[model samples]
Structure formats: C-alpha cells, structure tokens
Target: MKFYTFAKSVAYSILKPLYRIEAIGTENFPKEGGVLLCSNHINNFDPPVVGIMIPRTVYFMAKEELFAVPILGDIIRRCNAFPVKRGMSDRDALRKGLSVLKDGHILGIFPEGTRSKTGELGKGLAGVGFFALRSNAQVVPCAVIGPYKAFRKLKVVYGKPMQMDELRKAKASPEEVTDLIMAEIQKLITEYR
Candidate 1:
C-alpha cells in the first residue's frame, strides 16, 4: 500500500507537468464495490496516466510481454498489474480479472485490447463485456484525450455507470455489451475533446 501511494504520487508529479493532465467526472466513480474502468487506448502511457488520477487502487491487465522485461515487469507487478496474452483468449487472465472484481476492487482495462497507432478509438473487444457480465462490478466508461506530448493538455473523463440492468436482464451478448461501453467512451471523447 505504501509503495502504491508513493508510485502514484511520483507518477502524478511527473505526468502532471509534462502533460498538464486533468481529470473530469470523477464523481461518477462509485465509492464502493467492484468497478471495471474501461477506456480507449492511445499509447503506452495510458494505464499509469489514468490510474494515478483515480482515488481507488486500479489493478490493470497489461500485455503479457511487458511482464517479461527485467525491471519493468517487477515494478508493474508490485503496482498491481497482471499479464494477459494479446491476440487470443487467455482464460487465466480472465479468471484473474474476475477475481479482482469479485473481491470488490477496481480493475482497469483498455477495451480496445491494444493501443491505437492513429490516435483514434478502436473497436472494443468482447473480453471486457465478458468480465462485466460475469462479475458484479460496475462498468464505468472513460476517455483519455490529447497526446502524451510534454506540456500538452490532456483529460481523463470518467462517465457514469452504464445502464447494464436492461442488458443483463436480456442476457445480452458480450459483443453487444462491448458496443454499449465503447459508444459511451466515444461520447466522452467527443464531449471532452
């Protein structure tokens, strides 16, 4: 816990001046229970940038390759990041994410699966929807705007908890749930940008 706080503060100090980062709509975040923090991925810096701003501890699912790097792997692991295989379904990763939510913690996921090279929001994968449907976590859509360039203005907007009751009642497919979450994220980007 101490290390997480220290890392968050250091990250905030470095990122705040560099990106002039601002967080909006944080009040939409629930004070308790499990949460799925879904967002669009633009760069490698997205996870730390968004995680630092949120008051709750965010456990993120990073690409499995990152966990193989010598120093970075250990650091991210200590900071609550677990590895997930990209380009395929990794049941282990899914179970880890579900366990996090089931334990009433925040799990951060980039629904697009990977970073976008063109700085546009990509289509969200169904994995996030699967997590939302299987767990009791509240799915929250977020948007990260502006580039990671130094001194540039950037914003992280957290939208309200999605209306999942209807979808759940109807036994919505994972693809359908993903579409709704992605659409909300797009709305945030349009409004905040």
Candidate 2:
C-alpha cells in the first residue's frame, strides 16, 4: 500500500480504540472527480479523524506551523498534507489547493481556518468559498463531533454535496458561498448531536 494509505490505516486503528469513531452519510461522498471536503475544526485530531473515514485519500490543507515540527511534520507531509499560512491570503497555498482539485483529488479544508477552543463552530474563512468558486469542485460539508476528547464517541457526519452550478454562474461572492457551506456544516453538527 502507499504510505498515505498505510499511515491512515495505522492511525485509524489506534484512534478507533481511543475514540468511538463513527461515520454518517458517507454515501454523500462523490465516487470520483475533484472534491473539496470542508469541515469544522475542533482540534488537531479533526483532520485525521475525518480524513481516515473518507474512502478517498484526502490532500489536507494544514496550517503551516504544523510543518515546522520535526517528526510530526514529516508524518503529515508523507500522509499527503500541505501547508497553508493562517491569517492572510496565502496565494501559494491557494494555488496548491486548486492544483489538488484540478488533479481530480480530494482536498480537505477547515473553513474556520483554526481550531475553536470552545468547541463552538466559528465563522468560516472566505478561502474555502474562494476555492469552491474557483475550482467548481463538489463541496462536501462534514462535521467532526467530539474530537477534542479521547474515549468519547467521535462522529464525522457528512452532508449532501452542495452543487455550485447556479452559484458559480451568478459569480457568487466568496463570503456568500462560505456562509452557505458553514450553514450546512452546522446543520450536520446539529443533527449528529
């Protein structure tokens, strides 16, 4: 198996025991083509928790700071994660994310841009909507419930993919698209609760 797959398997095996990981609405995932998996960020484990549940190999857009660490950085990179600068419009990161979608791969993103210490969903950054509009990729809204604690029942529930055909044709603003995506994610979280 590829390193990414192997690593994800190992991580999932370890996590499965620590947290009761359950996936809901996984049928909503697209069988192929470029997809943008947008989810709420609760903690560092949110990425791998959601990523491993999905059948596709997700190329996660992680914070650049995580890449500064020694072995942890290498592990995430080997698992198909790339860095994105936080708190600014990082063009390099944008291009890299678009490229992932353009290659018909799954690109995982946290629209909130950062983890919420309170576990309350925060406002989504416009970058996610920008990428959705720019790449016209399928946007799958996901919710990672109970990620902040171990031995808890952690759930990753996916909502239906949002079609951007009309929105794209109208040239919707990034903020508008982001709001819509966040709304869907919120709904998933509410339902999962």
Candidate maximizing lDDT: 1
Evaluate all candidate structures by whole-model CA lDDT and list the values in order: 0.93, 0.91
- TM-score for candidate 2, please give it: 0.96
Per-residue lDDT tens digits for candidate 1, residues 1-193, read 7788888999999998899999999999999999999999998889999899888999999999999999999989989999999999999999999999999999999999999999889999999999989888999999999978899899999999986777888999999999989999999999999
Per-prediction backbone clash count: 0, 0
Instruction: Give per-residue lDDT, candidate 1, residue 159.
Output: 97
* Model 1 ranges with Cα > 4 A deviation: none
> What 10-residue stretch in candidate 1 is worst by lDDT?
161-170
Model 2: per-residue Cα lDDT at residue 80: 88
Cα misplacement distance, residue 127 of candidate 1 (Å) = 0.4
Error of 1 at 80 (Å): 0.5
Task: Please provide TM-scores, in order, for all candidate models, with all chains considered together.
Answer: 0.98, 0.96
